[model samples]
Target: MEATTTSQPKTISPPISPTFRISGGRRFSNDTSVAYILPSDQDEVKRLKLNHDLWKELMNGLFKSDMHEQLTKGIRVLDVGCGPGWWTLDMAALYPNSQFIGIDMADVFVAQDLPSNVTFEQMNAGTGLEFDDASFDFVFQRFLVMGLSVEQYSSSVTEMKRILKPGGAIEILELINDYSNASPAFARIGSWIHQAMSARGLDSFIADKVSSVLETAGFKNITDVNYDVPIGPWGDESGEMFLSIQKLALPAVKVMVTELTDTTVEEYDKTEEQAYKEALSHQVSTRFRLIYATK
Candidate 1:
């Protein structure tokens, strides 16, 4: 968490209109090189923002990384797979002295009156991170379960390790797509999502394997925390919000999952409806893993 650089943060304007291709009444990334299948339209933006707020509510803060001191003094930070730049923008506001760079394959940058220390870049982290070795004091990525395959995730971990300065911290947050204690209705929905992800070379269950990836990349002092969060009215206010998030998330991936799994749209819709009912009838939960380590 020690400061590695004292460089001033830079500001860059984002593209006002990013390119996208329509699919199944939703919009997705136009870049074929990137493997992320989720839609990048305004609806998707709403879902991502909701998910970010849910995470903040659950974690009680922006991130779990232990680098606030370094960030306060000044350092370079990188946010990989930063869809919509929610996390990056919040962190930038929290640490004005730190320079923030949020990179994503899709051109979904937040182009408002952005802080001078914040910037967004479009790039695929699966191939590699476009930065010098030991260049950043902090590197972060979250919820990239659909964006990268196992090999690509491993490669990105190596890239993150390579770009992190010595004594610097790197944090990753991910979740399993399937829920524990899943009802029959919810199980069907999870099955379709898992199968679709598998067909695309992505593991919806990658949340459990990230610590090993970080270890192989030579990161040290690793901290792996698994949070079992509820997703139903039975669990209270947070659960209610997460339940709402689930409603949006399933539909968000409907276009990709149905197309990839060869499942009829009618069937997906039916199962998804049943899953919501099942969630309310009983308690269903999922685990989110927050892994942080020093390089």
Candidate 2:
């Protein structure tokens, strides 16, 4: 892998600032500029690892964008909202020739010994990216449904387009926030999640509108794909894995959602229990959307 270059002329970023606030025994990024609701503690780290593992297994790779050849040949890459730096670190290892920069609002980066080609920086993508124009060959963001609101997401795409070199590709993967053929229990949980998101000016169903954002940002050759993965044993190994992910994910969001909405901890726990059972009986699955385009 190439050594990480710190003073590249093409790169210009602001000083990093990471701030936090504690709530309900879980630590979270307290920046009021963002509607991010997830905890940033080690328990959340375990959940993220599980989620990343499941995503890799289901997709059969680190990403869905058509960048394998470009990555192998080496290019400058940026990972937005790179929680724990798992994907950035993994991709750097896989494509040793490529340079990777991962950015986030929190300093919760995972690896102590980062690969030479990879560097983790602290900056909130929602506020604005500080990188120079046309600084990167590719930009990738994933699973930020709970972190970015609709307006913030749109502006972030514009910033991504500005930083991407001509003809550079940008890819985003997001959950649709609603389940397919949901049972009552799952539906209830979805309602609470929707209420919580709306209370913060975020759209839980924002994945459906990403194409418009890319188009409005003047990106071309846009391609969007959707995957519905099962949530329980009935759907096989993937389902079992997703079920485990959900078990942790719901609790991760509980501290924030309950605070935002009328939901009580007791009611949330009960619904989650029922939702797990419904997952088995109803064969529920969550939908994910992957959108890619060129600047």
Which portions of model 1 miss their true places by more than 4 Å? 1-20
lDDT of each: 0.84, 0.85
For model 2, how does the per-residue alpha-carbon lDDT over 225-282 read when each residue is reduced to its tens digit?
A: 9899899998899899999999988888888779889999999999999999888889
What would the per-residue lDDT of candidate 1 be over residues 1-295, giving only the tens digit for each residue? 1112222223333333445677788877666566788887667777877888788878888777888788889999999988778888888878899999999887667876777999888889998999999999999999999998888999999999899999999999998887888888777878888888988899998989999989988999999999888888987988898898898998998988788997899998998898888888878988789999999
CA RMSD of all predictions: 4.7, 5.6
What overall lDDT, based on C-alpha atoms, would model 1 receive against the true structure? 0.84
Model 2 TM-score (2 dp): 0.92
Question: Going through the candidates in order, what is the number of backbone clashes in each?
Answer: 0, 0
The candidate scoring highest on lDDT is 2
